[model samples]
Target: MDPLYLGAIVAIATILVLFSGVSVGLGLLIVSGGFLVIFDGMRSLELMPEILFGKLDNFALLSIPMFIIMGSSISSTRAGADLYEALERWLTRIPGGLVISNLGACALFAAMSGSSPATCAAIGKMGIPEMRKRGYPDGVAAGSIAAGGTLGILIPPSVTMIVYGIATETSIGRLFLAGVIPGLLLVGLFMAWSLYATWKSGDPNLLNGRSYTWRERFEVLPRVLPFLAIILGVLYAMYGGIATPSETAAVGALLCLIIAVVIYKLWHPRDLWVVLRDSTRESVMILFIIAAAGVFSYMLSSLYITQSIAEWIGTLEVNRWVLMGAVNVFLLIAGFFLPPVAVILMAAPILLPIIITAGFDPIWFAVILTINMEIGLISPPVGLNLYVISGIAPDISLKTILLGSLPYVACMVLAIVLLCLFPGLATWLPDAVMGARL
Candidate 1:
């Protein structure tokens, strides 16, 4: 059978099964199993267990659960509300102050936590009500949290980056450094849009914010100081060659546990138990999808589908920039349905070679791709962050949140353009700090 025709049939079948409401992990497993039986014979089933186990047995991959636990420890405690209070005190004097504070707070939290939904759940639990109390529009309040939460994947220590690096054999440390500038750029863009929208709304109600006294602002710092120290410590330890990414995660997780128990008084056995249980559940789910993706990728390799696709792309007559633009547009559309991890698993294998052939730096492209995934998290309909915020604040309609998030989406698009035009935005820091990659 022709590989192209077989690939089409497999793709269509997978889509049909996914649309039928099966869970993503189950859907992927089912589709991959079918492909194995049909394309490689039933004998291929014998290697399935080994393949799945091999996928999860990586040193860097271990960092995932540790980071999740660290994030969950903060989430399960009062750190989120305290962080919000600290930012709110400083940001409220300006128009759209609460909304700006929400964005800032999410960015800060993203530095500590690497998952989008985790960031949303932690901060949205406190940010939404405060925004409502400040007289901001419903759409803007929900939209900012949803959009800001997407930063979790773009910032350093991102789980998505870890998956991408392992999948494509890119350096995880370089990928972390690569994301820093673009992530900060998105932060600036989101804040700018928040300021503009608030001013344009012309709501006198929004102008009624009361500023915190200087002493009050200083007092709230201790609440967030420990978390901030963890973020800096992890990043520095990784960058300074003091520890590997996985080791840094372990140390960070240990410190977070200490803070939760010692400072937050979560010393009760039940409280500690809940954090471990919840973090483990979330970690297992993610690692399972990753394992399933590995088996599926092997099947794609067996059929030579990835190579065929890359070859077909290489034959195109268009310029590299034009091809990249088309790829970005396709990813944006695909983001509407697929989550970032699945998207990276399915597309990175096929796309990375074509990108390398075009003479683009893989680390730089990693940053660009990470930014696209950031936008995906906030895209309407199936964007995970949108549903997450809605769950947190049931009163806000999905449509209102989607509409409010559109402006931040534009900000993300601008960041993509800037990164594309000047690749250094993603590459320079990693090169300057880490020295040139071989």
Candidate 2:
């Protein structure tokens, strides 16, 4: 049996199973196991343990749970409300002020927690209702938080970056630094678009927000200082060589607990248990997907499928720019149906090599991939963030949320193009800061 034929069959089977409503992890495992048995017999079954363990046996991968826990702990506290309140006071005077404040809160939350859904849940719970009560459009309010929540994966402490780095053997620290600029760029673009949208819609309520006095703005500062300190501390420790990515994660988690218990005093003893339980559940789901994707990835390598595809791509003689554009388009389409992690897990093995061969920097490609995942998180059909926002604001129709996300999705696509054109946007900071270390 030809490998290409087998690969074709596996691809078709995955689509069928996934579309049939099987979960992504189970679907991948089922398809991969079937192909493995057919091609390599029962002897290959024994290698499953090794493949699973090998994938999980990474120091950087440990950070996923830690980051998730920190985010969960924060969500369990009043920090989300505090962060939104603080930002709202300062931002309301600007056009589309509430929306801008929501984006700002989402960015700050993303920096603390690397999970997209977590960011959406925290800020959307607070922002959406407040925006709605202020007479903001439901779609626009929900969309702002949905799209902004994607920053959880693009900003530092991003689980997506950690997974990508561990899977590809890229430097996790450098990947973290690389995301900083692009993340800031996306934040700016999203806010700018929100202002334009508000202005164009001629919604006076959205634009004519009250301004906070300097004293009022400073009064809310204490509410956010604790989380802000931890974020800065983690980045500084990592960049200063005081800690590895995994260690930074550990420290961040500890600091979040301290802030929750000591400073905020908002976390009850029972809340700690809940946070742990929820974080563990989310982490297990992610690891299960990683394990499944690992086996699938191994099967791709053993069958030489990825190499064959890369070779075929090389022979096309297409300009690198054209190939890059095509790859972005394909990823954008894939984002609509698949969760970001699964997309990276399954596609990175096949796509990263091709991008590297085409003279693109892997770190830069990592940023580009992260941004693409951001767009997918809000896309329709199966965008996880859209559902997250919907879950938080049950009254906000899914259609309204999706409609609002379209503009932010456009902003994400623009950010991707900008990163592609000026690779330095993603690479320059890491190059300068990490220098020889990177």
Winning candidate number (TM-score): 1
- What is the overall TM-score of model 2 with all chains considered together? 0.94
Per-candidate local distance difference test: 0.85, 0.85
Candidate 2 residue 120 C-alpha distance from true site, Å: 2.3
Q: What is the lDDT of candidate 1?
A: 0.85
lDDT score for residue 264 of model 2: 73
Question: How accurate locally is residue 416 in candidate 2, as Cα lDDT from 0 to 100?
Answer: 84
Clashing pairs in 1: none
Q: Model 1: per-residue lDDT, tens digit, 316-426?
A: 888999989988987887677888887887778778888987778889988788778888888866888989988998888888888988888888889989998898999
**All candidates' TM-scores?**
0.95, 0.94
Q: Write the per-residue lDDT of candidate 2 for residues 164-257, one digit (tens) a residue.
A: 8877889998999999999999999988987787677776888868777899998988879888898899899999999888899898998898
Regions of model 2 farther than 4 Å from truth: 203-205, 436-438
Using alpha carbons, what is the TM-score of model 1?
A: 0.95
User: What global local distance difference test value does model 2 have?
Assistant: 0.85
